[model samples]
Target: MSPIQDIQTEIDAHNDIFKNVDGNRSKMVKSLGSTDEASFLQQRLDDMNQRWGELKAKSANIRAHLEANAERWNRLLALLEELGRWLCLKDEELNKQMPIAGDLASLLQQQVHCAALQKELNEREQLVSSTLDQARLFLADQPIEGPEEPRRNLQPKTELTAEERAQRVAKAIRKQAAEVSEHWERLRANVVSWQEQLERVLDKLRELEGAMDRLELRLSEAQDVQTTWQPVGDLLIDSLQDHIDKTIALKEEIVPLKNEVRAMNELSGQLVPLDMQLSSITTRHLDDLNMRWKLLE
Candidate 1:
């Protein structure tokens, strides 16, 4: 059964028990005629009335506990509904962003690869530049190597005709020119390729950076929502907790009262016979007073 129903059922049961106990006491009181018997019945009636009072108090307490629990339950249910709505909104927003997030991630991965390739190209370019610098330095130091032969130690040697020397020098110069032109063309091609790769890397890096910024903005927005809700959530929880605390306090108050009633019940049970004797003794004492007064007259 439901909680409320269960509580009501228990209350009904307690009420029935109290009614039966009271009814039985009433019947017993009607049957008694002797003063001592009447006195005992009166004491029983008083104990039964006290028990009724305790039952009434218990019923009130149970009702208060139920009402407070119901209130807290309602608050919890509302909080849960609010949370559900908030989560639904968040989920919808996240769903809307999913495709964009996927695209950005793919682009970022591609950019990473492109950046790596560009880095490699830059390294190659640096190597090529260093090689050219070494070549230039080698050429600059060429004349410094080897010593010139002394003219005094040289034998008279036959000199070639100027036209012949010019022809031979022209042929050698042409060959060197062809080699230098080929080397410079290859270097230019390498430089162009490196520049293209570097540009691609820089472009990809920029795209990745933009994607990162967007991601950070989205995260910030999510954090803002969380921060906003946290306090509201805490307040709701605190309010519910306060309700629970009040319910507990009510129970705490009721327990001592219940214990006092129980103690009174035990005392009543102990004193019943003594009260009956006092009633019987008083009845006989009055009879003796009546007889002595008649004799005295």
Candidate 2:
């Protein structure tokens, strides 16, 4: 029979048992009125009633446990649903707009954004972990299976199905937790890729900035040597040699500057479009440097 029907039948049986016993108790009291045995019989009946009440209370405790289990099932479903929606939304958003930065300022900002995104993912991961633990705890604490139960433990088949139901729910929750964790890993990979790309761009920009700054200083010093060429307190047979050595040293320094510029451009490899201003400035300075070098020659 169905659980509800079985429960109703049990209720009816209990009510009939109590009703007949109560009627018999009333008849006995009436029959033994004002007798010494009447008080002793009343005490015995009171003891029996207390024992029966204890039995009823045990049944009530079982029913209360069942109700609590049902509430836990609902809680697990709700948490899984909430976690699923957040995972899906974040996955879609991350895929749609990858991190891209055109300049160092924006690149630094993108790094911050990525860090914050990862922090959010970490929080979600913890929630998923706790939810999975809760599911496992529910499974551990859920009622035992009917088939494994002894004959004395028998109940309505439908009510005994609670064990199977709990197992299925836990299984489903486990599957969802796995999927959510996978989604989190995917999002984390994208963030890592984004951070790597940012590092590449930032490294290139800083390298170029350093190289260009050095080039500017060396070029200015060389220009001053060429434009303001006055021998410092010297009139000797080897005076011409000093000028030639000075020019040669300046030429050597400028060669590395050119090499630095070339290496940077090659590394950048047209993949990242740097600012036009930096390129234009480098080109202009190199042209002036070439003209200055020729005058020294």
Candidate 3:
């Protein structure tokens, strides 16, 4: 299946899941006939909460992917615009250098200007190609290398007679002119290729835009589902809070009672030692009195 179709299928499945959850929630709410029914409702709510969390995570991932695609598309579009502007400027410069009709010096000057323009164009093309390669690699999640050094054509020099030197100069000029013509032809071909590539990029941009729209719609629906579940979640939270408050109050009521019992135990321990001392003193007094009675007898 096509990618769009696959996305639609996934969306439909999610919608079905959402519908099932909603139906289960409604049924559970209506059937609150016993504690078990309430427990089941709570369980279902927990499950729905987990599902909603999963859906939110997935939605974030989709948004991130869309953002990355958008960045790539924008970069590609910017590159095309820059290239178009550069081409227009170069064309204007070339037009300004056009040779006047039937003027030899003007024609020669134009030829020289053409040669210079060809060299500049070659350098620009190389720079543009490198930039495009890097951009492509970036979008593909690949490593990008540094720009390569431009290649140079080297001509060997030789010691020769004046006639031979003149002949070599003439030959070199003809070769240079031919090279310039060939470079111009390549530039024209490259322009055509760029146009075609631009069209392809535009088509891809449209596809991405459509995908973004669908994702946004899905996100909105998911938000609505979340909103619907909010009240149930809030009710559960409030119930838990009430239980917690009751437990705290019970603890507070028991603490002072526990402290009073501990204090009474400590007082009882102090009384036991005093009672032992009193019994010893009474026994000693009785012994002394019996001794005194024996003396009297």
lDDT: which candidate is best? Answer: 2
Candidate 2 residues lying further than 4 Å off, grouped into runs, are 1-66, 96-99, 139-175, 216-253, 270-297
TM-score each candidate: 0.29, 0.51, 0.33
Clash list (residue pairs), candidate 2: none
lDDT of each: 0.45, 0.64, 0.48
- What is the alpha-carbon RMSD of candidate 2 to the true structure? 10.2
Clash-forming residue pairs, model 1: none
Model 3, CA-based lDDT = 0.48
lDDT of 1 by residue, 1-297 (tens): 323334445666777776776778756776786679878877977987897687667656755654454444344334334433433443343334222111324435534544454454455555444443533433342222233333343356856423223233333333343444355445445445544543444444344344434433433443454444434345675476765665465445444333333343343243333221123443353344334323322
CA deviation > 4 Å runs, candidate 3: 1-9, 16-19, 22-56, 68-72, 95-104, 134-297
**Residues 61-116, candidate 2, lDDT per residue (tens digit)?**
65566656866787887787788788788777655544454445666776777777
Best by TM-score: 2
Regions more than 4 Å wrong, model 1: 1-11, 14-27, 35-41, 68-72, 99-297
In candidate 3, what are the lDDT values of residues 140-176, reduced to their tens digit? 4421223332323433454442323323333433333
Each prediction's total of clashing residue pairs, residues at least 3 apart in sequence or on different chains, is 0, 0, 0
Q: Candidate 2 — what's its lDDT?
A: 0.64
Error of 1 at 190 (Å): 47
